[model samples]
Target: MARWESGAVEPDMATQAAMATIFHVPAERLSALLWPNWLPMGELFHVEGVWSPENCHSLLDASGDLMLERRGFVTLAAGSAAVLVREWQSVGRAVPEFLSGTSEDIALGFEGRLPWLRDLEDAHGGGRVRRFVDLELQYANELLRQTGHGGAGGRRLFRVVADLCRIAGWASADTGHLAAAERYFVLGLRAARAGGDRLSGANLLKCMTLLLAEAGRPQDALLLARSAVDATADGPPRVRAMLTVRQARVHAILGERDACERLLGQAETAMAETDGQPCPDWALYFDDAEYAAQVAACHLALGNYAVSDHLLERTTRLQPASRQRDGVTYGLWWAENAFRLGEPERAAAHLSETVPLIESGFSTRNRTRFAQVRRLLHPHRTLPQVRDLDARAASLLAWGA
Candidate 1:
């Protein structure tokens, strides 16, 4: 508090919200009190926690969104987490209901466009689309308070919020803002739980698992993946299949080949059960190509280079070019496996193709993978092809920096 007053520090979004709860005031009120110039004192005191209709409309103005740097977790105390959970539960009810459209209409409008937004993220990378998505989410959240459907309407709105949060979290992680992504994922799960949408909650957990695993915390990834499977045990078949695939990846990381294969088989069985059923919109993209990519990843981790290379070949061909991030990732994996197979020329060729996509997408996730590829090729830098690859890799890093 002293540091904050001294202008040497400021609370993060989570901290500010927590403080608001403790002070029995709204977060914006706390902000206004702390920084007198932020909002007119008379209006701030009158508005308190809830925004007036005019204020809500004005908040929708598309000013630039803030970008926060990533940080590791400082574990929440049990009591604090519980309080946080309660605060999240009240979010929908607390929102000021001043939107032009009816709640259902607003939700449907957002839902209808979400697929397009998701596709844009997949094609161009998170840095390009995150701000737009954030603005849309803020608008959707405000609409929740004004929805007209009673209990049913509230649940539907909450479901949409959950999905939007999940997408935003994915984009954050892809752009390397892991701390912000963690906050978004937690909020998404909270929204899902509030709405009694176990499937969406579990899906968010699976995404968190993927982020953790990719960031080199396999144990944390495994725990979250297991939680997802258990939470959705009796939920949608496709979602169960997706979570099980995540389990297999963690098993592979643990070097348990038999365990990995067992879970993979289970994942396949779960997927088969969904053959004639309509899967959740989020799980629809976890198709054969995605399955193959998971399998390739497991084998690659286990040092089964030949098998990984074969599976990656199929994955690369089957995966659409528009999903530039995934394409570049798969290409990097293929190149790594080729290098492990004593084929530097093949590796160099794959790296050459991947570099362009990585540059175009500007993904930190793919850039990190490329860094590993560069390190793997360093031993052979004397070769002309390796040297050329190294030069391109350096240029890519410089441009990103």
Candidate 2:
């Protein structure tokens, strides 16, 4: 695409007008001036056989910063930082959160008390393996700051920053940046401390448990779940429930069926206390569907596929459109469970919808889980839906670099 303000290319009348509005060009030259900065989303995405460079240039408004920010917000709006990172990865590049390739994360990253964010981004190049550890480091730092930074007002301040850290960490984890995700979880812990919110601390620990399980370190994840329980032994009922839900998943992943069932009982007890009481600030992450989805996932991991399917179907019904990334992610899990229970056609149907959602997010963490979907498709490549999904997965897997 040509630069929006550049006096280089000559333009047709319509193109000039469109470019002028996009770039704030002087009205006097609207008829004669070429609008250089007009790249479309498809072109910016570099979708193969989708759009020519010229068409892309025409579609974009042509301010590099504007273009980058627009694209970045699109990903964020979709509740997916992973998608943004993945697409950038696909292009063999790593653009900073501010969409800058010219600067290092530390020097120009988001200017809050988030030094850890930079560290998380710097740890990966092309998708090596996972960035969980790096994310944990950041999560730890954020928690430290959030839990005790402002004395009496510490909790409130921590609330603000910790929220960002949590989202960043979860995003990192969802995308398969395990190290980076872990750092965010740890940072969230510190934030809980700074805020003097024991409930928040417990929530962070629960997050750690989930991350550990997701990373296939089920034993360690189970230990983290115990720690979460111990940390929040005297905390709010809902907080306790969060920990139990987490523990249930960890135990299920470890194949400790008895322990997982027990934890599920505990989670139910905690949930029973929701008498319209205000939720703890840290627990804001979970609404109804979020809770149901976690429960369903735990069941799926435990080989109780029928119950899992029922719970998951309910969860999907309750899932708000706003939770697109999570909804899609969980939908993939449901499909996997269906496959396990011998429903190939349903699996294919789910995969067809899910592959596009995952692509839009480009999250490495979700991609790791999504590998299950890919595996299922690979075996049934002769099927139309399976072949289509396999191709999409292949394109995305290339970004795991």
Candidate 3:
């Protein structure tokens, strides 16, 4: 056929072109011959290593409106070459509300990826940040890749990665893995930096400060919290409030009531100006229950058992397990309050309850706080359960049991 023919068309060429495009097949280009002598459908999910274009064409294609979305699970999506999976299913299987089911349909043959993603998270965290180091690295790697792409989507992903890193760090600190928590905190800082969010970085630093405070290094925690506060002062009201509250927590740990109270007042002032000021992303975790609970801990540490008791009871009742049961801090709060109220039996009981959750298990942050409370109980270390718990707390008991 000539390139330009007057009122003449080649039916053979037109049919060949239409067939090639219709079935996603390679056509008569020189490069097509150099395509490694391999089939064009080498990337098929289940039916690879065979010429299956005819079979592929037999399968029904989705319409323009046919769509499937992954609400939270990114792991399953990445398992397939496509980031988004379309809706296509078979009979006799239970309809899954989440993206956790296996893909058995011929058109969608890839299985779920959420389990692998969760495995990666667990390997780093061993179920939480305090128990796993291997999984933390992998989780951070995944987040780093996701946040590398610039734009609103990148920022959104960066925020998620940042939150996960912070969670891991917090869990690490709670489980007594201070160094691992610190590493997570650093990665969280990097994630925040990727999104150019100073407030998020400040929040990560706040987490780090809490870790230090939990390690019985209130001075260090106070310093870190102060640095975060100073850096984020002009950024957002909520960010500033969170830093100040953390600083107050450090001071409270140090038994510096006056300084702690001042910081608490600052936090309140920041919170009171909610009319026009914007809340930084970091402070979203802060609320009335949190403030009250933290302040109660401060009082408990400072020997104000009555005030601490009131606060602990209120906070505990305020947020039930249906809402959040992983609050090792709340457990510590109740235990300390019981200890400070001259209730050795109750204190020991609370310790017994909180110990398994904090000492033998997760939360180095909780351990350190428990240790502090244990120190407070040192005056009565000779008591029965206290004697048993003193060993668990690793307190200053030099003599024989």
Candidate 4:
């Protein structure tokens, strides 16, 4: 057991089967799965137990530890993920009951700081803000344990904690802690459900959808993405547009061009309907520029380099300077598209513009993208422009090291 835990060796099939039996997992499952993947690791397996305050508290406790201790991306079986989505869909939207208290003030105070924390993350990246967000989530969890859940005050507190969990989950993913991200997202979904915050729950589902897509489970991702859209069908136009765009992204990944295009059109129409109307604070960031950038991602996946480049150009121009991480990401995408179009010089130029931003930013995800772009440009290294970009990227990689 110690050897297995320390990565020194693998358990043989017989031992794995025995262990599965000991853990109450079906022994027959061992033939198709390896150790750990077969283990019911988180609250997801027990999603149907109940949404009581006690269960939410237990989930918070487990997920807080998950964020701190778990490592690597644990791929849940596709069927398990589908089960989770189905349970989320069937869960009642009623707020849970709780002991009345004044935690509302505390929760409100935390809420007041969310926008600033989000801005800080946008400017600097997840590595810079992950610990801070984790600490906030911990504190919120502690508060929840103390205050109980489901009154008006408790609902507000749960919603605030859910938002924190959302940010924490994103930060975890940004820093390459995907297992932790998945757990935190599930925790946030539970909290949102407890609070009856359907919009917040939908947002968490959307985040999970993207995470799964990035993890190479587009089928599961598509299921969750559709669930997110269905959950928020009556939400504000901007929010609906944001979720619809995400669904379009999944369709693009699955090579369903017609479905992708249809969803994109719907997203655009919904965005147009916003017309300056009020939107939830969480949905405010999905403006025209962000929309274009996301659309560019869809086209990028569909192999429309020229169209993606055009949309990304507009995204770069319209993106706020304060959104440094996004600027770097969009710049890298633009570079990739340019290179694919047989314009190495243009690609290198755009890549060069992102060097400084990459230097100042702290996102592992962006850094990975930068490395991929570098590899894409490697064949053209004989070109003077590409050579220069290569040297610059090398310097950034060395600095990161």
Which candidate tops lDDT? Answer: 4
List, residue by residue over 1-401, the lDDT tens digit for candidate 2.
33232223456667756755786766765444223323332122222221222222222222112212221111111112233223222322211122112333231233343434433322321122123323333443454334433333333444434444565556555544454455445545444444444555556666666765554456666666776676666556677787888888888888889988898898888888865756654464466677889899888988899999998898889987755667777888888987888887778787667777777664554566677576765566687767666666676656543
Clashing pairs in 4: 98-149
Q: Which is the leading candidate under TM-score?
A: 4
Compared with the true structure, all predictions reach lDDT values of 0.68, 0.55, 0.51, 0.79
Error of 2 at 22 (Å): 46
- Candidate 1 vs candidate 2: the TM-score winner is 1
RMSD to native for every prediction?
9.5, 18.3, 22.5, 5.2
Ranking by lDDT: 4, 1, 2, 3
Model 2 gets an lDDT of 0.55
Best of the two (2, 3) by lDDT:
2
| lDDT comparing candidate 4 with the true structure | 0.79
Model 3, position 215, has a per-residue lDDT of 45
**Which residue segments of model 1 deviate by more than 4 Å?**
1-66, 69-106, 148-150, 397-401
Report how far off residue 324 is in candidate 2 (Å).
Answer: 0.5
